[model samples]
Target: MIVFMGTPEFSVPILKMLIEEKYNVGLVVTQPDRLVGRKKILTPSLVKQVALENNIEVFQPENLRRNYQYIIDLKPSLIITASYGQILPKELLEKIPAVNIHGSLLPKYRGGAPIQYALFNGDDKTGITLMEMVYKMDAGDMIEKSEIEIDSNDDYGSLSEKLSIVGSNLLKKRLPDILSNNYTKTPQNEEEVTFAFTLKYSDEALDFNQTSKWNHQRIKGLSPNIGAHLIIDNVVVKVFKSQLSDIIDIKPHEIKIENKRLFIGCSDKAIEILELQQAGKKRLSTKDYLNGQNLFINGGMTNE
Candidate 1:
């Protein structure tokens, strides 16, 4: 039997594909539900919600490293993981064959946040990698891979959705060889490896001193979730969307408001803030926000 391990919306389609293909998925393992939003409502991960809907057994272990004996006892023939959030224990991996549907091409962007990094770097393309899972983080023998181009406007949310669907399809196409133990494993080249570690709190802060394209990429990489923010007047203003602008006269970190539009200066040029949210305020379009408030009259923001 196959035990599917994943969390988040990115993993939902992969889990559903296994079910649709009639694979013997014995249990679904996901991250625990946690409090979310200002009201602190407890919420299940998207993968867990899908598993429940499909009548599959679900498991949420707080610390999989210490409490993985239950999974071993099941003796699942294989463990398939995708964005499961936790590294599998060596003891568990030694006992069962496991594979992962990683979001990027193997030996590159090998970590917890590949999808975000792809956008952050302004990559022209990124793809899915289906590979064997070992003790190391994403350093496994590749089984199959599929490439997808990254559109100029694709943000974290849109790119993530594309990768997830591609991942599900890739896994479906290779399951026959995987289950039958008929696949060839190609080792990854150590020289080509790069890591895309998880984003930290500091990573969310935008630096306008960087080039306009650089700051624009940062906004795209974090959008629809952990937004890129600027500290203006000692208040945090989150920027969810932006576009490159022609204004070049404004000094770096300076703000320019003209014709109902908001622009922030960067090293090379300026980036027009398309969507933004002030502290304790709902997100609004630049046009809408300008219609009501005169908060950004004449001041330069600091990197700090």
Candidate 2:
């Protein structure tokens, strides 16, 4: 029997793909449900919800390190993981061969936030990697890769959805070779290795000291989820969309409004805020926000 491990919406397509292909996915392992949102309502991880819907058993260990014997007891012939939040213990992998469907091409963005880093660096392309799961993080030998182009307007939400689809389909195509132990393992180049560590709360703040394009990429990298925010008059405003602006000659952090357009000064150019949310309000377009609020005024400055 095959064991599947994953969490988050990114892993849902992959789990569904396996089910559709009639893989004998005996058990699904994922992180435990936790309280979410201001209401503090308990929420199951997306993968758990999908597993239940498909009538599959799920294992959510509070700490997989201490509670992993359940997985070993099952004696699954193979394990497939995608965006599984926890690292499998070396002992677990020693007994069961496993593979991971990673979000980025191996030897690049080999960490938790590969998709976010790809956008942060303003890359035009990103891809998924199928690799052996070693004890070390994402430093696995690659089995196959599938590339996808990033649209100029793509943000974290859109790009993640795209990459998730690609990742699942790639796994489907490669599963036969994987099960038969007939796949080649290409070791990633040590010299080309780079990391995309998980983002912290502090990483969400926008820095106007950078170029407009740079800040724009930052906003896109964090959008539609943990949004990239700016502090204006000590109030947090989450920015979800922005564009390079032609308005110039303003100092960094300066706020400019003209014809109901909201522009903020960056080091080299101005960035026009397209969509944003105030501390206690729903997200709105720049024009709608300007029509209702006076937080940003001509010549006023945002907190740097």
Candidate 3:
């Protein structure tokens, strides 16, 4: 029996694939629900919903030992975790070699926020890594890996969706081998170890003082969700899409509209805004935005 552990929409495909292949999924384990957004609405995770649809037993564990011991008691043949937030304890590892579906090519970005971080860092390529779960943070021997290139304009949301689909198919292919016998894993060099860590609201605020190239990375990393923002006359403006410029005469925190486009020229880099959303307005192009409001704040393009 396979014990599936995950908690997001990305994890749904793998779980479904296992069921389609006639694998015995003993139970699905996911985290407990918590309030989200201003409404404080509690929502069950997407993985939980999928498992319930399949009539599979579900475990929402607040504490690994207390709530999840029942699953350990069942003694499933294998445990597969894809985007399961919590760390598996040593006791649980003793029961079985947990197979994890990680987003990045192993020995690379080894953490919860791999997809977003990769886009943010402007990585040329990222892939899915299948690894045997041991104790220390994503430090297991990799079972297999597949790489996918990041497009110049690709953001976190789009990249994540594609990678999730790739992960699902790769797991389907590797499952038979993983379940049958032990496979070799290459140890990730500590020197090459990097992190996604957890992204925060503050991280999403774009700083114009930095080079437009770096600003590009920050915006892309936070794209599609938790987007980068700018403060224009006490109103928060989201930068949904942008590109770098060679203009070096413009000052920071300034917005200039020219040729029906919004270009915020900076010290060494200028940002060409393609799409944006004001605090309470719908996202629209620079031309549409200009037409919508008569009074707009036009900060100085001059460094002075």
Candidate 4:
């Protein structure tokens, strides 16, 4: 019997794949339901929803370290985790042969926010790593790795979806071999390791003092969710899509409107804002937003 532990939408694909392939998934362990969104409504995790739909037994422990005896009782032949929010207890790791499906190439971006960090760092490529689950965070010996290119237009939302698909496919192909002890495990070189720490709301703020390229990367890295933010006219505006502009000469954080298009200045160049949302307002394209307002070139926007 296999036990799968995961949370969030990223883990749903793998759980679905395992069910479709008829794996003996004995239980699905995930984080507990919590209040979400502006409404503060309780919401179940995607993994939990998938588990219930398939009629698989589910467990949600507030503290896995203290309450994992139930998992042990399940007699899981193998344990697998994909984006599981909590670290397994050391005792459990020592007792069970567990594997994790990580969102990046091993030894690089090895932490909870690998996908966001990859886009934040402007990596040209990112992939999935199937690795042995050690007590340390994502420092396991890798069993398999698969690569996927980060397209120029790919944002965090799109790239995450792509990585999810890639991870599930790779897991489907390698899991049987891994279960039978026929797969090879490779120790990661510690020297090349880099960390991708979890992001906070503060990390979403944009700095116009940086080059336009940097700002563009920051925008795309966090777009469609946890958008890159800036203050305009005392209102927090979340920028979702932007492109580097050839126009320059304006001071950093200066806002310019031309032909119904919105642009903001950075250190090196300007970025044309394609999509944005003002605080408490719906997201809109620059054209749609401009249609409701008129601006003069000399009227500047404040970062404060």
RMSD of each candidate? 1.2, 1.7, 3.2, 2.1
Candidate 2 per-residue lDDT, tens place, 1-304, comes to 9999999889999999999999999999999888986578999999999999999999999888888888899998899999998889988989899999999987999999999999999999999999999999999899999999999999999999999999999999999999999989899999999999888877788899989998999999998887899987778889999999988888798888889888888999899999999888878999999898888873244555
How accurate locally is residue 114 in candidate 4, as Cα lDDT from 0 to 100? 92
State each candidate's clash count.
Answer: 0, 0, 1, 0
* Candidate 3 per-residue C-alpha lDDT over 1-304 given as tens digits, one digit per residue, 9 for 90 to 100: 8999999877988888898888999899998987865467998888899889889998888887655568779988999999988888888998776889999987778888898788777789999999889888888888889899999878877787788888999999888888887456677778888877766677777777777877788878777656788876667778777888666667765666666777775557588877778887788876788777632445322211
Question: Which digits, one per residue and each the tens of the lDDT, describe model 4 over residues 10-108?
Answer: 899999999999999989999999997667899999999999999999999999999998888767889999999998999888777899999999899
TM-score of 1: 0.97
Better of 1 and 2 by lDDT: 1
| Residue pair clashes in candidate 3 | 120-221
Question: After best superposition, candidate 1 residue 216: deviation in angstroms?
Answer: 0.5
Off by over 4 Å in 2: 298-304
Reference-based TM-score, model 4:
0.93
Candidate 1 — which residues are off by over 4 angstroms? Answer: 298-300
- Sequence-dependent TM-score of model 3: 0.87
lDDT of 3 at 200: 69
Q: Tell me how far the alpha carbon of residue 231 in candidate 3 is from the true structure, in angstroms, after superposition.
A: 2.9
How well is each residue in 1-304 modelled by candidate 1, as lDDT tens digits?
9999999889999998999988999899999998987678999999999999989999999999998999999999999999999999999999999999999997999999999889989999999999999999999999988999999989999999999999999999898999899989899999999999988888888998899999999999999987999987787889999999998898888888888989888999999999999888889999999887777875447576
TM-score for each of the candidates: 0.97, 0.95, 0.87, 0.93
Error of 3 at 230 (Å): 2.5
